[model samples]
Target: MKTEYDVIVVGAGSAGCAVAYRVARESNLEVLLLEAGSADKNMMMHVPMGFAFLLKPHKNNWSYQTELEPYLNNRVIDLPRGKVLGGCSSINGMVYIRGQKEDFDRWAAEGNKGWAYADVLPYFMRSQHNEAGADAYQGTGGPLWVSEIVDEFPIHQAFIDAAVQAGHSFNAQVNGATQAGVSWFPRTIKKGKRYSSAQAFLGAGRALSNLTVLTHAQVTQVQIEQGVAVAVQAEVKGQSILFSARQEIVLSGGAINTPQLLELSGVGQQARLRALGIQVHKDLPGVGENLQDHWNSYIKQKTQGVKTYYSEGRGLALLRNIARYLLGKKGFLGDSAATIGVFYKALPQASSPDAQIHFAPAASEYDAQGNLRPIDAITISACQLRPSSRGSVHINSVAADAKPSIRLNYLATELDQQVAVAAFKKARKILLQPALQGMLQAELAPGADVQTGEQILEYIKSTGEPVHHLAGTCKMGSDAMAVVDECLRVRGIQRLRIADASIMPSLVSGNTHAACVMIAEKCADFILRSSLIELVSPTRPFGR
Candidate 1:
């Protein structure tokens, strides 16, 4: 069997699949993609509403738990990342959104060359097959499909109407024209099935002879020789196997694992490695710093006779959902729990946007089991966009199998707390409006008498949680603090790159699946361009 290939793409998640698909189809490169979990052949992964099952520490998900957060009063947060072939894309909310143009422009402003909105627009354009057809802002022919929700629920329309009454304008396409107001979100779904990045790219390209995808292969380290990445060491079926990369080793292990993989390969801080008893190969200080994620706070209300998703008994609901989904892909299962979203500037004339609101029609609470607790309720989740605070992820032990320590530092920044308070207050006002007053029966959370700003703030701090948009551990920039350069090459390593959500300089305003896909599209071009350059340049290294 051939042990070496042109590129060894690790973590067959959203980004890794994109990298493999592009390399195999666009170039003569032989791409070997490895995943830590089994194929996304799970029946749940295909069902639009099967996310509930996939939300747990399933075969396709790594049920990661965060270090106790000080702001949440030492509560441990469950961080569920996909371990399957499509990674999180196979298990995410599936809402598609290109982040605000300002977010990308800020990357350029922060010294990340070629990452400005104008420069990266092509990559975003190239990734989508928007149902809205060709426009200056949206693409027509692309690998992934983006469609408008065909069945807009009543609650969704009510939320949009309320936002409009509160001075927010209606936007037909937030990913088009401008990302300045409220709109129905586009999703990475086509024909009512989740169009995971793996399905769009890797699955479609499986017919190609040059691409090979291995599942249940957990990569432990990148094999480096004389400061150059040459292969990867992984545990396959409880036995270690080494697969060589004739040309390059790409780390698409994401924010948490990408840095961990680099550190295990002796490519991180010397003192930390020494403490762990691992021989250090490279003393890179920025491998796992700069972790960032969005935090969510909810406003819940109950409606009498309005029919919440929480009313149905578990067995009956499951059976009905299954039967409906089986007979026709249309039903409650086809809906994103939070199908209606509004991105707005909480404070008019503010320097940057403060809040993002997601209106979920379901009357349920996500408990520790990732199951919806039975109850009659719909929730408005308000998130602080572009948090001013930042956190870090680092190794806790020298053991390669140990989980990395994650400190979210959520709500640590005053601006973040302020935004949370404001957004929660605003949601209350919207609920009280005449448009929604008749539909809402009563305030089910934080109650009506909790009027003071301080009271609302306290409520938010006690109940806030993560939206599952983690990024920036191996940030890309031109600073000494950056783990990778603009082209995504590791600072001190050759023929190695990290192309995943980990490389995002900052988190996007919406769900990150679409943004991660765009990152892969851009990195594919960068890799292809560099490979062509090496093919002709005199500096191309000869086989040793």
Candidate 2:
């Protein structure tokens, strides 16, 4: 087997796939993409409704969990990271949300150049093949295929009406001119199957000879020689292997694994490494410091009349649904959870929308073990977009198999506490609206008895969980805590770059899959450009 390559892309997740494909197709750099998990061949990874299956602990799921958090009554939430070629995109809700323009502008304002809304919009557009077609804001042709919900249920429309009746406006496209109001979410599904990053980018470049993708290879650390990352040490089938990278070693292991890998490589806080009896390569405190996630809880309610996806894929219904999908490629299995989404300012004093609402026709709750408890119910879940609270992800042990310590520290900020109350009140107004009152039965959770602000706050804390949008552990910027520069190169380290959600200075206002893809797109462009510059001036190895 080949032991060396021009470039090594770690973790063949969303960003890794994009970078590998871009380098293989656009540049001649021999690329090796390594995934800790196996290939994206699991049938569940392709099914739109298969998220329910993938979300559970399985072979394709990393099945991570947080340390008992003292904030949420000492509850330990399930953290599922995709251990497959597509990574989280293969297992995510498939919601194609781009967050707000201000979210990116804030990044540029924080000294991260070329990341303003205007600068990053093209990358979003370039990665999209929206069913809505080409426009100023949306894209028509791209690797990732996005489409509007074709079989949106009647309850979804009524929920939108209820949102509008509750004082919010109806936006035809949330990814259009503005990010405010209620609209149908653009999903990462096409032709009745989930379109993950692996299928979108890697699938297209299968014919490329220079690109090699390795699965079931868990990278433990980067082999740094004289302060430069030249190779990666990995475990494949109980065998240790070293793969050399002539150019660079790109880390795209998302947030948790990326920082954990860095810390294991002795590239984190010096004191922490010294305490663990490991030699510190670089005392970069920011390697795993800034951890953040969007916190949310479902407001479950029972419906008296209309039928939600209460009993999907059970008994004869399963066979019928499969047959129906096979015949026409249209069914509930093809759609994503929730019908309509609302981006609104929960607090009037807030600058932009402070919360995002995801409303599904059916209701389900997670058990203490993080398993889904399905029911004949509807859910109006709201998430605080810009959380003031920040947590951290640190390695618990030096062993690569050991799970890292995660502290979400949700609702630690008073602003989030207030925002939770506002979101509940706003959702209450929508539920009580005459438009939805016909079919609405009762609020099952934090029901009619729980009315006061204190009660609502208690309800949110007890039931609230992360929407799986983890980021900022390996942040990018010029600050002292910034682990990587604007160009994504790890500070104080040569020939090493960290992409994926780990580099996000802050969590975007919406789902993170699309943003992760955009980051990879830009990273690939820069990699190719840097290679061209090096080719022009042989002595100039790095970017000029």
Among these predicted structures, which one has the highest lDDT? 2
Please give, for residues 1-544, the per-residue lDDT of candidate 2 as tens digits.
7889998999888788987887677666899999999988888778787787788898899988888888789999889999999999999989999989999999999999999998889888877898878888888667889988985367877888889999899998898778999998889898989999999988888998989999989999898878999999999888899999988889999999999999999899999888877778889999888888988866888887775777554678768878888788787888886667899999999899889999888777668765677787788889899888888998878889998989888888899899988987887778988888878887898689988999889888898878999999999999899999988999999989987999999999999998998898888777776764334233221211
lDDT (Cα, tens digit) per residue for candidate 1, span 237-277: 78788999887788998888899888888888889878877
Clashing pairs in 1: 363-377
Q: Weakest 10 consecutive residues, lDDT, candidate 1?
A: 535-544
Q: How displaced is residue 224 in candidate 2, in Å?
A: 0.6
lDDT of each: 0.80, 0.86
Q: Candidate 1, overall lDDT? A: 0.80
What local lDDT does model 1 show for residue 183? 82
Q: Candidate 2 regions off by >4 Å?
A: 311-319, 366-371, 532-544
Per-prediction TM-score, please? 0.94, 0.96
